[model samples]
Target: MVLLLLVSLPINIIFHKVKLPSVMGFIVAGVVIGPYGLKLVDDVESVNHLAEIGVILLLFVVGLEFSISRLIKNFIPLLAAGGAQLTFTGLAIYGILSYYGVPQNQSILLSALGAISSTAIVMKMITDRAELETLHGQTCIGILLVQDLAVVPLILMIPLLAGTAEGGSSSVGMAFLISVVAVTALVVVSRLLVPKALSWVARYGSSEHLTLLVILIILGAGLASESLGLSLAMGAFIAGIIISDSEYSHQIFLDILPLRDYFSAIFFISIGMLLNLSIFIESGTLIFTLLAALVVVKIAGAFLSAVVTKNSSRISFVVGLRLAQAGEFSLVLAKIALDEGIFEASQYQIFLIVSTLSMLIAPLLIQGSSKWSLRLFGAGDETAEGPKKSSGSLKDHVIVVGYGHGGQNLSKVLNEIQIPFQIIELDGESVRRALIENFKVLYGDSTRANILVQAGIMRAKAIVFAISDFQATEQGIKLSRKLNPDIHILVRTRFAREVEELTNAGADQVIAEEFETSIEIFSRVLREFKIPSNVIEQQIELVRMEGYGMFRGISLDAENLRKFSTYLTATLTESYQVSGECWANGKTVEALHLKALSGAQLIAVVRGNEVTADPDAAFSVVAGDVLVLFGRHASLVKARKIIEIGDGACEKS
Candidate 1:
């Protein structure tokens, strides 16, 4: 294992730097080291097992980001586009196989395999390009999800069609019946049980535990499906879909990502191990013919489907061209078909040749897709428009990039406070939501200068970049600072290592979620151990003060530290200040009988520079005093009205 890692390390590095897929590099390395080449690794089974883990992790993360609500909203297009693609592609392949005089069972299996595109490769490519939030990307994912779901029945039907498994026709009938039952049960269980189970797990707050549970679920589901005469991959994919709605999905993805990377590397390597170069050299003409036929059929089907779904000509062309490549699961289906005597060895060889060539050429096809699309759709006549003007003036308004969870939460708070803000989002659905909510949101890429200008970055009070991609966030910060140096730029990051880069790019505040979560967890642990609250507060303040200027040269002093501490404690203690209404607007704490009715103590009142500490019981109330009160939870509730009604009065209780 160590040797394998050592050998593959340089190849992986080179591929990454060259902007090529790492899995492609892994396969190349595998081919060089396999029996047909250098003969380095002989145990293919172990490598395959390792690679399978990567597949699970990849799919799990994909599921984590799959929003069912978004799918439902675009269900009609998804069904139309995806269904048409599958039907046409399958039929086209079937026709080709029939012309070649292939057996009926073999033709169906081959056609089904050809109909499916690579969920793994397509998703990885989209994610690498940082285009997963775009309309085209979402459409691709939705179509891929439908295809992945279809693989379940296809796998179950394989054994029956091949006559390899027991119970004959009854087995085929049972398999179909069982699949329907399983799918329905899965939906019901996902709706009723998964959420509660995930919630319970989250309450425990152990990421490692959650990750282990996810693995178990994936493997367990896969095994169960296999026992019911279905594909393990299908089960794993379904398991991913079920957990996609869970709140812990993100964390689950993060935890399993490393495993997925390792396994996917192995999976590609295993694919390389299966290839016999000698046979390819001998059957050159036949291999080339099969490959050409596969690409033509698949691309034609996808293109027709894309057009039928009402996508732009360019989008349809790109989708068709991109999906011409055969996928990983196609190999599995071919193997099953061969083992069941549905396809002869030569036919299997043809399948392998076509699939391998398709995989190898996919990147090139994708790269040329835009050019091809332009040719297909007349140049300069693309349907998609350039950036549009924002509703409001950009001056002094907050510019928010990325309308993800963190950005959404921030927007909500800003809305409540009536702060002028404009959002830049790539996702069409998110952009639509923002517009419907009467927000100043523009659909554009934040990394582009024009997009930033459209969002009013020049005169913006602050720019909050909550994009998940580190590179994009850094680029946005750099551009925003160049556009307007005086603007306050806040960035969100997943790791502390990204903090310095964002800071160097001119971010005023770099909020590292993981770092913050760590601090929060440690603080909770301290509290659990019965640490003194004041001591904990002091420690937290000290750490913040020391680290404050490390990124942006801002520091917290004693006064500010005290204020933060008070704010934290107030929230922790559930004590809040509510403004006084017309009835008690002019009354002092004593006159209002606050102590008697609410059992609350007035700690201090600040009116501009005047700080009245522990005012007398008979002190007359003023309209504009900023109240700093300390009280029981029930007392704070009773005093809510008194704290909310006064003019120029803000709560810091």
Candidate 2:
């Protein structure tokens, strides 16, 4: 265990710095330190036991993140695009392997393994680029979701394929029955009792206890499945799905993440330990051939599937390239095949090297996919007149990108004010919603130059990007600026850190949710303390002019700092209601010597809806009178103290 951690830490860090996935680093570390390389760790059995736990935790987390609502929401892509990609890729590999004289069952297993794409690498890259909400990102994720589900049936097929079971059909039927009963019981218990148990634990248990409970649930499910002759991973996955619908899913995932990473790393390293470098060196040609076949077949399958779902050719091709590699699950399936006697040592070595190479270059493929697609298809379907042409010729209009909350609100105000506006949306569901409301929405990615042109970018008065996808927003801003140099561009970002980058990308104005939320909070707080509305507005304007610099710890010049200090302490009005217990219950304004003591003036005094403006020295103050004082902040504080107590209170201070 110590050896695994010591070897993986620096290796993973180096990989991370080089912009490679840590999974690859772990695999490489395994190969370097395994018996095949340095012989640092030759006891594979002990490591494999720990690695198995990693696989279980890995699948458990996958289930926990994959909520049922998400499945239903993406059902179309999951069924249409995902099903097509899987069928096409799997069939192509199967045919190739079968033609080479591989046995039927072995071909099926290998093809299934080859059909899967690396969810870890692709998700991390898209998430890092903030493209998860982009059209192609969603399509890629949907395909991965389907592949994750496919693992269950593949695992179940292992024993049957290996011919290790006793009664053939009867054994299979009995096994299926047991599996069904076990899964049903697990779901029922999770739905009916696990939530209540979790609630009780959360309410009364310490955080440590909560952690232990979740760990128990994961391992207990695994044990139950193993006892019933099912895979531990399958049982844990089912448990995760049941808990995913509950509110505790995210918290549980967060709590288990450290363990998952640790174990998953070990699992990958163990797979590396199985590698035979001698075999890899001898079969270089075969390895490269298989690698080429894997990429081409997967890309073709994914591209065709995306096209069948009506995705633009550009988006389809990009999605295809993004998924053109075998993933961690493929390694898992390969290990099972090797253990089941389906793959010879030489074949496993070849498959392992091919899978590792595919993952190593997966990020580059995804990063270059857009440029590749554009080169191949030359603007593709984005140039087609989508909803933009249907909206008719528009000029001096506003172009809104992403029909999300910001876009919707902007559209509503534009309509009320009778301003001409057009919306460019990429999400199918969002586009449908906009069309339902009779919005002049173009259904395409705004990052495309042709899409911007179709939206009257050259003639539009302004363009606003209210999308959460930062990469798309940045790209759209640059494209819009390139299309129309004079058009005003506004961008909204979730974090203030992204403001400068978006500005550099040609956004005329950038509003960050973080700083705006901070400003709103401080504004409300000042209002509660009776600060004048005009003064509050001034503070807000000053902050905005400085680009929210104050909130982000940006240093201000002495001149600007002095100006802000003056604005904050500038003379302002603050009203204080006189109480019966106050010292000024029956005193005249002049007799109180208000200005002499606190340097504040009693500008107005209200008594029973009768207000006295610029009260004279003779105006009397009493209980229930609302004294409106005007002065600097410090002066107001002193004046309020004198009014509440006696002027002697000010003298003592």
Candidate 3:
């Protein structure tokens, strides 16, 4: 284990710098240090043990992320898509292998292997690219969830496929039934005990105790399942699902994250150790040809699955490309196959090599999927309901380019005013949300030129880039400006450093979160110090006019600071609402003698929107009247007390 880390760490560092996935790096590290390469450590038993733990942890985390409620909620739309994907992909692989003289049972096992895509790799890549909420991302997740669930049945099939089950078909069916019963019982029991136990630990135990308790639960569940003829991975996953519905699930996930990552890397490394490099060198052409065929078959199957489930052409194409690799579960099945004599040593080596290569290529495919999808599908709107043709009828309208918080608020304001506007969002769920709210929203990547054209950017009066993806925002700014030279482009970025870059990319106005937050902070501070509202507004206006330069480290001129200081210290006017129980309510201005009592002049009294300015002393004040007073800060403070509680508090003031 120590040697594995020493070899893997530097490789991972270099891989990170080159933008390669850490999973691939760990696998490569294993290949280099395993017996076939450098012969650094030939003993494999200990590594395999650690690798088993890693796989269990990996599945546990996956289950934690995939709560039962999400699975049920997404079932209606995603079920057909996910099921079709697994079925079609498996059938295609089975057919191809059978045509080549592979035995029926071996072909079936191999097909299962080819049907599942690497959830770990695909998810990590999409999350890094910030596309996990996009249509294709959601589609991939749904399909992967189906694949993960399929692993159990696939495992059960292994004994029957290898002709090793004592009761043949009946045994397999009984095993499936037993597995289901065990999962249900585990969930029911954990649901009753886990939450209360966690709550008690949180109330009375240290974090270390909580951590240890969680580990105990995970391993104890695994051991229980193993004792009942089930896989440890299955029990860990069930444990995760049960805990996911609890309030402490997120905390548990965070606490176990380091262990999960550590074990997961070991698992992938063990996978790489199983491959024989000599076989690859001897039959390189055959292996490459097989890998190419697998990629094509997987992509085509996934694409058809999406199309069959009524996804738009763009989303379908992208989903196909995104799921073109075999996953960790594939390795588990392959190992079982090897043990059952479904695979020879060399054949297992080939499978391992092909699977690793496919995983390595998945990230590149996902990163370029949007552009490839646009080219293939002609940039049609990919909405949750299906493709909708873009209209050019929208003229001089605001185009909000994301459906997140900023975009949602902007759309509401535009709708309230009855302004012509359209929204372009990539997130399928957000697009659905916008539709539910009756907003005109188009689902597609705004960074793509065709998506921009489809949104009628040529006729847009203004476009707001309200997305958090800075790269996409910059590209959209440049593309929108090119399409509509006269249109206003407003952009919001999270960092001050991005302001100059966005401006150079043709954004007419850039709002940096850093500067805006600082501006708001200072404005509130000024309000607390009794600066008049109008004066604060002027300061805010001036700050914006200077492009937030003052907050960005551009020094304010001495004269301006002096003027600001003067405003802070000058006599100011303030308005106070008269409550029914106030001392000044129902009192004549002359009788109250506000000026004499508090040394603050009553500049005006507003009654039901009628203003009595500089009135004679006979003017009467009433409840609900707004009193406008002019005075120094200290005098205004004293006058407010005199108005609130009569002359008894006036002496204290």
Candidate models: Cα lDDT each: 0.71, 0.80, 0.80
RMSD of each candidate?
9.1, 6.4, 5.8
Backbone clash pairs for candidate 2 read none
Error of 3 at 219 (Å): 3.9
Which pairs of residues have clashing backbones in candidate 3?
none
- Model 3 segments beyond 4 Å from truth? 52-68, 127-131, 167-192, 220-254, 370-653
Going through the candidates in the order shown, the clash numbers are 13, 0, 0
Please give the TM-score that candidate 3 achieves against the real structure: 0.75
Model 1: CA > 4 A from native: 1-6, 13-20, 41-54, 64-77, 87-111, 122-137, 152-181, 190-216, 227-230, 241-258, 282-324, 339-344, 360-402, 419-428, 440-653
Weakest 10 consecutive residues of candidate 2 by summed lDDT: 378-387
- In TM-score terms, candidate 2 sits at 0.76
What value of lDDT does candidate 1 attain over all alpha carbons?
0.71
TM-score of each: 0.62, 0.76, 0.75
